[model samples]
Target: MPEKNVPTSPPTCPTDLSLIDSTYPVGVPLTATYRLGFAFKTINLRLPVILTKIIDQLSRDKNEIGESCGQEARDDVKIVVGALAKFKNEMVTNKPIYKTGCKIWDSYLEHIAQLYFEGVVEDVKWYFAPWLHVECYFYKRIHDAFQLSNHLKSFDPFRKQKEDGFECSKKSSAQLAEYVLSSDSSDAVLQTLLEVGLWGNRCDLSLSSGEEVSQLGNLVDQLQGLRNFVLCDESANFWKILKDAKTANPDNPLTVGYVLDNAGFELFTDFCLADKLMDRVDRIDFYVKTTPWFISDALKTDFDWLIERMCSGDCSDFPVLVKLAERWKGYVLSKRWTVVESEFWTYPHAYFEMQDADPELYSTLTKHTHLIFKGDLNYRKLIGDVSWKPDTPFKDALRGFCPAPLLSLRTLKADCIAGLRAGLAEEIESKSQDWLVSGEYGIMQHAQ
Candidate 1:
């Protein structure tokens, strides 16, 4: 890698830099940075909180975690603690980054240069960098710390939280499972499950600073009350797209793919929704995180674990859950429901970069009838983490990243939004000041 000197101040832009609040260029630093601003709090507080928690976990002895995986565990605990302490210090001091041993670290260096050349920020310091870039970078560094460990190479610091959260959600899970098992293919059931799945996103752990969140309320009853919170409901169109494909070829079922998000209750709701859609679609592909990420992002282990938990007891204890699990297991065994992991999902690249950066992955996605992107981070990447006008056409904002018809099931957790009616944002603003950052609103946005 070529060396470049860090400037004493931010560099001037050589290329056009967007300033519109709705569509501000993501890489560029906002002027008059506030001490308590979202970016500042995220870097100074949230990131450190997660890092400190990681260090705490690593510092734990094998006896503390309730397992003695033997000397391998002890050696790894020592190595992991040392690495996390170093990484945590770097974050607290806003130290200049050292290249992590990740393969993409070199590419990240190239991006730093690209950001400088485009006059984005002074350097890639955590506090000054783009939220999408810095947040993803932080998680990658966490992965690296574990990767450097021998016995703990595949250890997930977040695994216990994932399992515990699901355990907490079993009541909700059983209720939904019972509903799905006894329910017929009524459109009401479909819509109810769809809305239930959307609200499940509110239980994200990353947004709550790594805390375990569960779904407690009656999901079916709450759907009507939560109706107004849906800012854009192209849900009918989402079902129509699937319905049309099924109508076209009753013999050949449509292929559906989900770029899934957080685990626990959310994944359970997603499974419930998928169970209902199984009759309409031949196969449902779940694209899970290859690595533990964003505190609670779902992984292959999460998927497998959830199934095993549901199927563990005899059908008498929780008959509906066991029945649903048995059906899901059957699907997995027959290759009708497949779980896919792509390292590409872990990369920081925006959706638009998919065609140029990972065409094979892009081509693979094209096979799906609809590629459903779930939750906020995926939504941010889909829209390039920009400040596009609230009403920017979803298709236009996508900038030709559509390999297949896409539906984004996202709760508003960031300032960026697109595809709203002309006056809807103002109306929302009139009612609530921080509606955009709050998880109170969501959208089921569809674009081909």
Candidate 2:
């Protein structure tokens, strides 16, 4: 369980995120230079709080962790805590971000220089570097602190938070499972599951800085109520694509790839979608992070944990969970559902760069008929974390990344976005100026 007393509330800041001015060119990477922007607030406020929580979680779980991993792990816990404290200080103090001399990261810096900067850049600071790179680095360094340890090298500081998040959402998960299990393979059911998976992006722990969050009530029942909030509804297009693919390849095996996001209710929603998709698609491939990332990204362990709990735990109140879990287990055992991990996912590179950065993973992705990318971070990478015009076409914003026909089901949580119709962004801003950074609104954007 997570340390209940650890305070992870975000510090109060300006609610009107649009008030922050951006001086970068239209296609430049999002940096924290804009004082009032979400990137800046994330660096100066949210990330440090997240780091503090990691430190606090370590301290609280000291005894249990030690017992599990042995005495060396206990001593290493103090060391990791101290390292995290120093890391928090570095971020809070606006210290320069240094390159890890590792080949992969250093090459990425070179890639950034060749692509974004004109090559003479040197110092990368917490408050001024590219938001995506620095943010990923922050997590990488946290893992580094443990990777250097003896007994705690495999320890996931974020495990408890991920577990607690799932526990909190079991009610909604069971409800969603039952809804899917009882429903027919209708377009309505598919659309409902897609929206549920989209809204599930809102439960991200990184967005909340590790605060407990849950999916509550009847999620399927709430779909219509939240329909208007979908800024871009490409579901009709999505359905057409699915229909075309199924009709054209009736004999050939059809596969779908899910570049997964948060691990709890969001992951549960992902499973619901995958379960629904299995009726049409032959195989499902789930790509998870190799390490604990951005607080709640699913690791292979988290993927297994949820399934194991559902399969073995007392589900008297929600037997459908066990039924669904057993079915999913059979799918896994039969290789109908495969869990995949790649170092490419943890890298800071954008999706467009995948061909050059990790060709094998890119080749693997091409075999899938369509890729469903979930959450804000994946959306950011899809567009290279650049600030495109609000009305920019999603494909144009992709900058030529077409691994497969892809759909990004993302709740707006950052300043960067694309594929809004003319004047749509402004009209939404008139209602809620903070809509860009707020998770209230969403987009089901498609790109081919």
Candidate 3:
């Protein structure tokens, strides 16, 4: 099939280089720079054909097709990578000029560029959609910096807060257990987990401690309504599956695998969900990225360091706090009775490439697994990160790609949401131009 179409016009580059040069200081906050960088990155990485569609749509003053929008957004990403690659080539002859961060960024850019040049873009586009691409870039940049700086890792802002959040949940899990036992409905556990999930999103560690605490409380309060909204057919089916699993093997532990996203409050929320699961099941395991200090939440596997930081009460250096919050949202939704780790995130290859680079992780995922892919990042991976029709069924969107049972629980943090009912796409368009791409709405799908 042809790649999804997108707009084609070249994005207007900022004339002032000073805008890019402005540094964010410790106290004075400026999110605009990052947002601009994100936009630029998005426009650069889009496929050329998709870019043409976007230009066509924009020229005609029509809404861009799903694929076109994705391509246009990613086009800037391509430019950024290209520029960095050029910078890297220049560095071979002109050393002592580029900063360590830039150098690392260049290396990652080169890797991505190679992927694009090798005609792997189509296969990997699903995995490297703009948001996921940005995330991967962020991690690689940090990894490169650490390598250059005597292997010194940076502090993640979310790590300490997430540890504290987990501890708090541990203390409250008994209370949650009491509530679960008192309420006879299976939805009780799901409801509590939903509240915990929302809290995870709000209690973002990137923000100040005070802000994080306040958001946590707010999310906790909103659980009752979210619970009511979740009483659909899927909810009923989920409970049925759980019941059958319990009946078949009373001694068998229910495994809840968390495809983790970001660190901090989200991580804390994930811990809370895990604690709650222990009330219903037998064991819990978590999977996280194996990289150094990249995205905050991916560092959850490094629990030892997180615990120490929480004890010392120092968490200020971690960047990408908002992304961490988004990932936490995914983490909260995946909890069940027992949790197990999935090593896919930590592996270097894409999901399709996993069979060769990390067959063990792939094999483990295919066996006795029900994956909860969290956030837009995982969604990109699940759907090959390519643009698809808005009305595509979730399973069809995956195109028979996934090997095991899986569900995508994502708040539309980025463009490229799929698996909508026929009119659902129209409804979103009529109500708000940004609805499909906005993070306000969510999707929950199961792949058998």
Candidate 4:
């Protein structure tokens, strides 16, 4: 287990917690505008109930594990669930959410209130619903605790800033020449490269003038060399497998599935991958959450207010353009990919159990489909988002789960690193303490 970096300061309460507690709960039923306030209250109350179910399951399974497993899992869940129950009770009783550093707590609570008033309660709730609200809600509470105690010095789980200086430096002129001369399939490669580049550019953390267009141009140039290696005799073997699958089962369409993440650029990347797979396969099915609170760009569902705002020229800045491109990409991809929205992924059940419960969903997912899970949150879900050691093997971490030919493409945005090569963790530790959580490095893993 990872050691907790606790602070040695007394706890304090935020001044605005009272304001937030009173106004938020009352506003739920009294608001005359949108029903968002009521939605937020409903979701918040439901969180504790969901968490109670998870806690019950953990207790039942504790006796079946080893001494260490039983002790650790039970202890961790007890502390976490206990903290959640205390927090919820405090809220119900109109107590301050934070004991110290009240200003920051107030600011965050105000932000939550504004988001609710602005009709983003559904997005906020869905984002927190995973793992019965244990992960995100715990993080939010931790943030509040640290801020109140003035313990920012000790809390360093997330990197202070995104690592943004990486550039592809090498060139393969000879390979590029051979690829151009030998293949009639260059167009597919070029198009795939364009889509990935555009998606990356649009979603980039840093904003720029014509960033998407500029990145698209540079990506086309950079990928030409990479494409050559991927298309070589030895590498083309994989393509042959895909081709054979397509040829032998013409009646059974090849399905490409995307387990989605955040909206905008992230969704664009899913589209790029979907388009590439669609070029080779017969069909594509994109899965999304079915609840109003669970909808995201990944589902290609409409956010009517946001679309209307954009259309009314409310968002005209370069950064806004990048966001607009993200929504537009989803709109464009929905035309080709068969979109399936479900509540299973949002539930607390294990993947195989979810599959067992919904055989049709699993059958559709497992048959002829190459599943692509995107971003940090999805990666967490894929691995159960536990506190595995940094050097744990990917296969070991994923022991209980298997869902088609899967590839997890993610920039490291949180704790819980695994599948490291020998000495890779040591090398990273020697150079930077924050490397694992920095979102600097990425992974391309295929667990079949």
The TM-score values for the models, in the order shown, are: 0.89, 0.93, 0.58, 0.48
Total backbone collisions for each predicted model: 4, 0, 37, 7
What candidate 2 gets wrong by more than 4 Å, as runs, is 1-25, 113-121
Q: Whole-model lDDT, candidate 3?
A: 0.44
Question: Which prediction has more favorable lDDT, 1 or 2?
Answer: 2
Clashes of 1: 4
lDDT of 2 by residue, 187-260 (tens): 88888899989998888888778888777788888888788899998877777877898898788788889999
lDDT of each: 0.77, 0.84, 0.44, 0.42
| RMSD of candidates 1 onward, in order | 7.1, 3.6, 15.1, 19.4
Better of 3 and 4 by lDDT: 3
What is candidate 1's CA lDDT for residue 207?
71
Segments of candidate 1 deviating more than 4 angstroms: 1-37, 64-68, 103-105, 116-122, 314-317
Model 3 per-residue lDDT tens digits across residues 240-336: 6656888998888676566766564455455555544555554444666666422244554544443344334232222222233333344435543
Name the weakest run of 10 consecutive residues (lDDT summed) in model 2: 1-10
Give the candidate number with the greatest TM-score: 2
Name the regions of candidate 4 deviating beyond 4 angstroms.
1-133, 136-241, 247-251, 291-297, 302-336, 350-353, 356-360
